[model samples]
Target: MLTKTVHSSTDAYTNFTRKEWASLAYQASVSLTDEERTQLQGINETVSPDEVEEIYVPLTELLYMHTKHSVNLHNDQNRFFHRETKKVPFVIGIAGSVSVGKSTTARLIQALISRWPNHPKVDLVTTDGFLYPNHVLEERGLMKRKGFPESYDIRKLIRFLSDIKSGRKSTEAPMYSHLTYDVLKERTQHVEEPDVVIVEGINVLQVNKKDRRISPVFVSDFFDFSIYVDAEEENIIKWYVDRFKVLQNTAFQDPNSFFHRYRHLSKSEAEDVALSIWKTINGVNLEKNIRPTRHRADLILTKGEGHRVEQVEVKKS
Candidate 1:
């Protein structure tokens, strides 16, 4: 059974400790390798193989179970309608603030879920791809709010999801390059028909709550399941600053890097700038856009120091 600390004010999710959620895996074998974990790590974001065995293995098993049930439900609905509609891909959305490690979580999900029986195909796409191109952001004077909701091309993102949910055999999803810090003008990632799709982004769960009556669908409407990766603001700030420093030593040193100017900054100067950006941009965006959607997720993974998931909370079915 899960352990929860609910007060009179809390009404929805039944919280689970890491151990309790791990038990749901029924002791499944660890199929993810160290090399795979290495591939999944983002800058300053490291996911150990042990964490995969303990945390992600069970999570993916549960998701696979959910996918099977979702397929059956889709079939049942089709039967009721007297139509032969094909089952859509099971979409798993991972949402959180910048530097909260949702991208690595999404990649691990794709890797682990693909190892399940039938070796079902899974495609992981980051919604950074859905952000408006640099020129577009510049034209709109939204360069400072690059990761905020207003910086995204929502119509394009909605159409992309609509295509997959409508069972289109193929659709193109644009790719965002961290090195260039822009959407590649000539490149696009193809979302071929797949069994599962894992989408990671800060705004994946942000829905239009005020205009729901007029809006036909929100971006999160396509998700079969959603996980919100969360941590204390202080921890996320540290991670963001640490990542910025790492980027300064690595990607920012490249002549073609969009952040090349940062590579020349002294250590203290870099730290100051990182903290300032977090305080002004990322922090404010979190309060206004990201954190508000936490309750909309099916599961919440709260992290402790050292970026470990300390607890899991699942909303009642």
Candidate 2:
């Protein structure tokens, strides 16, 4: 096993301002090029280069180190195996509440890590593909709880991850349609062997349940490292409201969108609807299912009111 202290004693987890945290992040072990820094400049409206350096740079460094160690471990284990066996992919999981910017983080990390000299091939897959078809959700009366753990095909997701980690030559994941808010039957995405594979979702770290017995092997079991994006509940609620309005005027306006009706609501009416959905659905799911997994993450990114990452909590191993 590789042993080294990962966190610094002077690292501030909760006391630093966003800019101060960002400065410390840039000083971490990871190196970022000027071109990459320029590319990161476009992260949403709230995230900045400083925040990326402070929050995501440290995260990417930790993950890269863990992945390197995992590769070494796998190579050692394979010493007794035949030469025909393929190398296993390094798996990472990212979890967070809705509107907390976990998707952006996942995408950003995938971009950054793939550019690393030691790991040139990286791929990203999301658990949204494992969500139950819209018709099934409607039949089960779970349309309002779309992000809940029960809304996903947990067994299929586990099996898919298992196959990918087993060094399968190719694996297929179902495609989810934002326009229909459901899984597309005829559509699938193929994943080949990669140096790194990031699986992201609201509940990617949740344990599996089979009838009355809890399975020991969870989705997180496949992860070499995991991260959780966190922000205050009030701030997340505000973000949900703002994003819902933007989608209402844009994607929701598409005739085939599952939320097409929302596009017709007045601005104030839409805000009210958005807040209600956040409170009744997303907010409750975050509290009951998502937040509990925070402690399981190898690292945590805490965001401030401005939506920039203000603190990083890394578990000392």
Candidate 3:
């Protein structure tokens, strides 16, 4: 159980250490096997089964509680308004720096939430697909600032979220190919009446000032819940470089991969390239755009060394 020592004095949030948070895991209804847990981890991510049990289990239980209440509220409101009750998917947004393990967190939550008998259908989508196509980015001279807030098609992303929230069937999102470093025009992720949708990306919680006057709708406006993963910049850089080295030997080796030209480089050279990219591109975006939006998330997961979640902060109700 969380103690007074773990709680922050601030009115905005209640903070808890890992052990304090884990004590709530007993409330989690489902468990995962080693294989299932392994499958949820991202490349070079250091999450373990024990970590999943201690961290994500209780988190999913909380999401379930929120979803149940949302459904009940929707039903009561519909009856009061004399309108037909409709199923609206509970949308969860996960945001963070490029290598901060947001994807792993989203996947783990989706897996755990889907295992429940009531909400058997859960879908996960990455906002990489919402990014402008490579040619468009090149034309707009945004290729260098690829992951920044201006690089996304905010209007399209909002429309997609709008359709999902309205319970529209067969809504589709563009598919991005990391190997090709581009969007596949012919491929799309078709989402159909899911019980829950988990949207993961660095831009999910970003607020585009450019769109505020024109649209008045931010990307996170449709989110029922939001999570921000946090880690020190140095640690994230190390993880990014490590993942780059692994990709150099694996994905970069594929001739069709956008980064295939770098596959022949020595490990040191690969690490240098990764470091340069992080410092100039990803790190700049994280500092300027992503990290600033961390305060907007409903929950923040702070990671320490070895990509372990050391603490959690939940918005105080």
Runs in model 1 deviating more than 4 A are 1-9, 78-83, 209-216
Which is superior by lDDT, 1 or 2?
1
- For model 3, residues 166-279, the per-residue Cα lDDT tens digits are 999779999999999999999999999898999999999987875554477888999999999998787888899999999999999999999999999998899999988988
Candidate 3 TM-score over all chains jointly: 0.94
Candidate 1: pairs in clash: none
Question: In candidate 1, what residue range of length 10 has the lowest lDDT sum?
Answer: 1-10
State residue 248's C-alpha deviation in candidate 2, in Å. Answer: 1.3
lDDT per residue for candidate 2 within 179-245, as digits (tens), equals 8888989989899877788899998977755334435668998888888888888878778888888
TM-score of 1: 0.93
- Per-structure clash totals for the candidates: 0, 0, 0
Off by over 4 Å in 2: 1-44, 80-85, 209-215
- lDDT score, candidate 3, position 11: 66
Query: Which residue pairs in candidate 2 have backbone atoms (N, alpha carbon, C) closer than 3 angstroms, thus clashing?
Result: none
lDDT of 1 by residue, 1-317 (tens): 21332312136888888888777776567567677778888877678766787788888877877988997898899999999987889998899999998988888888878778778889988899889999999999999999988888877888899899999999999999999999988899998999898888998998755443435678899999999999888888889999999999999999999999889899999999999999889988988999888888998988888788888888888
Task: Determine the backbone clash count of candidate 3.
Answer: 0
TM-score of each: 0.93, 0.86, 0.94
Model 1 CA lDDT for position 289: 93
Error of 1 at 189 (Å): 0.5
